[model samples]
Target: MDSLLSVCDIKEDVSYIIDLAIKIKAGEIEDMPLEGKTLAMIFQKSSTRTRVSFDVGMYQLGGRAIFLSSNDLQMGRGEPISDTAKVLSRFVDGIMIRAIEHEDVVELAKYSNVPVISGLTNLEHPCQALADMLTIKEHFGSFKGKKICFVGDGNNVCNSLLLIAPLLGMDMSVACPEGYEPDENILKISKNFAKDNNTEITISSDINIALDNVDIVYTDVWVSMGDEAEKAKRLKDLKPYQVNKELMDIANDDAIFMHCLPAVRGQEVSADVIDGPQSVIYDEAENRLHAQKAILYHYLK
Candidate 1:
């Protein structure tokens, strides 16, 4: 638990860490283990939940969080990530990094003496997936045997979900356009984990089959932060997969809709679906704070 590089990095003992989160959320735990500690947050891209949640979550635990934009640090001026990681490690107890290049975060972890958390990267969004699982557990009371389907581009979010969902004994499926499937390595690793856990994980391009009997219907923007050039074609290709009433109708009657927000109204998901009674996007977003507080407590302790 020294650093959170990926969901696969969490060993079996991690269940106790999640239990700590549940206790902290219920106010059963009073004193903060990270009291007087400081977290150095490095961001190469702009954010909403990741920024605010980490800052506030740290403060609530009697710790300080310092936000450093690429422009605010010497690294903005072409400094090597290794040098930056070495320098920052001396000053902070932990480093949380959100960047496009996954390698930079790896370099940070390699050089830093303290923990390095991956806030987000083009290849994975582990913390987001963690919060998402937390939200799912809150709604369903258990992840075991629950079917969760993700529709749209199998991007970083999907990649991480594909990795972790099965590890918790949940069935996961992804529906994406041809050739847009999740990372091969992540999928391969997840398949192995699923085999060991006796869980099922599948992927397909057919949205209907993906949604059938799913307990959770999830989606993300057709075009992500770095895919502006494909926006038009994506809008057209993804139109059929939109989580509208019709698509949702194919899922379990009580199936909940989830989106890691900053959702495009008519792109990845429809406005009606996100605002619908089944939508828990806001709850998913809010849990970012609680789940991450749990992660911080686990590593810091």
Candidate 2:
């Protein structure tokens, strides 16, 4: 893959990456696929999982990762993204950017000669979606015929899941408030993939309907980065959609709970549900390392 700006870029290689992640986790592959390679991680937005996972993942691959915050680069001083991408391409083997605007990462990828990975963006978090898929595959053994329900704000995570689930032969339902629904363009593309995969994609304001008989119940923080001003209003609007015991009961009996991480206990998900027996949040978090290792290996190897 040239770059993973969105799930569409990795549509044909999702399963391969997942399988490779499983092997990496199982210690079946010991060779350093990324030996001597250097990955430049540009972060306009700070993160816990994204930063640490890629740093450790590159290290584990016998390579190195350089962390560059917004203040650490000329891009922070108003340099054009294309210029930054070109300069970085000449120095690093690859580039991973976590930015506030999706367009910035797109520009970086368009100009960079090496592979560019979207660490996270306002529109989509493709790496998290990959890790999430790995977690689901571990729990259920397959993606085909499975259903996943996302509750709360239809944010970047929801958009990425919508892009990926149907392509992998799984149904996805998104529950969000009226004005908080996922991007219409992404929904349209997901619908086409769903049609060919024999899976369904649904978006609605009703949480109960979305969770009905679903295999996985997923949620993320209602107020994501750059939306602190909307926190109070978002909490009020999304309060009814929180993934609590009552909401979990609406799903299948054996349905597992999943969160992307850094969850607010009483907000997007309840303490009981996130820490409960059915919760696979930790496994999901750990898979970020393995999943990203596979991604780096795919492009940098």
Candidate 3:
């Protein structure tokens, strides 16, 4: 793939990266595929998982990663991204940007000769979705017949999950309040992929209906990074959709709980459910390293 801007960018190769991550995590793959390479990681947004994972992943693969906070670059001083991309492309083997705007990453990728992998963007978090799939496969041993449901605001994480679940032979459902749906264009594309893959995608305002019989009960913060301005209103509107024990109980008995990290315990998920026996969030978070390693190898190696 040229760039991993979206999960659908991988198309049928989703399994390749996921399985590679599993093997890499298991120490089954010995080669340092990214040795002697360098990745440029630009951050226009603050991060925890996305930052540490990619930085350490490069080190583990015998490559180097340069962290460039937006404030440190001329691009932060109003330099055109095209100029920045061209300059960085000559210096690094690949670029990974956690951007506030999806269009910025696209513009960078459009100009750069090297591959650009999005660490996170307003539109999608493809890397997180890859690690999520790895965690699901590790826990269940297969994606066949699995049903994964996401609860709360259908934000970037939910959007990426929607694109991927169907492609991996898992049915996906989203439970959210009205006017907080996944991107319309992304939903349409995911539906088309689902149709071709013979899987299902469901969006519902009723949490019970969406969670019923699902294999995974996933959630993320109701208010994302750029949504803090609307925090009070979002908190009120999304209060009913929190993934508490009661809400999680609607899923299958074997259902796992997940959240993209830096989660607000009482908001997106309750303490009990997120810290419960079935919660695989830590494993999910660690897989970010391996999955990101797979991505780095794919685009850079």
Please provide, for model 3 over 1-301, each residue's C-alpha lDDT reduced to its tens digit, 9 standing for 90 to 100. Answer: 2998999899879999998888888898777778899999999999999999999999999899999998989999999999999999889899999999999999999999899999999999999999999999999999999999999999999999999998999999999999899999999999999999999999999987998789998999887887989999999999999898888778998999999887999988999999999899999999999999889877888
| Index of the highest-lDDT prediction | 2
Per-residue C-alpha lDDT of model 1 across residues 1-301, encoded as one tens digit per residue: 2688788777464456556667788888777778989999999989999999999999999899999999999998998888998898889889999998988888889888889999999999988988888889889998876999999889899988988788788889998888789999989998998898899889999887788779999998887788899878888887788888888899999999999888988767778989999999998998889888988887765
What residue pairs are clashing in model 3?
A: none
Question: Candidate 2, residues 65-179: lDDT per residue as tens digits?
Answer: 9999999999999999999999999999999999999999998999999999999999999999999999999999999779999998989999999999998899999988899
Candidates 1 and 3 compared by TM-score, better number: 3
- Residue 65's lDDT within candidate 2 is 100
Error of 3 at 190 (Å): 0.5
Clashes of each: 0, 0, 0
How should the candidates be ordered by lDDT, best one leading? 2, 3, 1
TM-score of 3: 0.98
Error of 1 at 299 (Å): 1.3
Which residue runs does candidate 1 get wrong by more than 4 Å? Answer: 11-14
- Could you tell me which 10 consecutive residues in candidate 1 have the lowest summed lDDT? 11-20
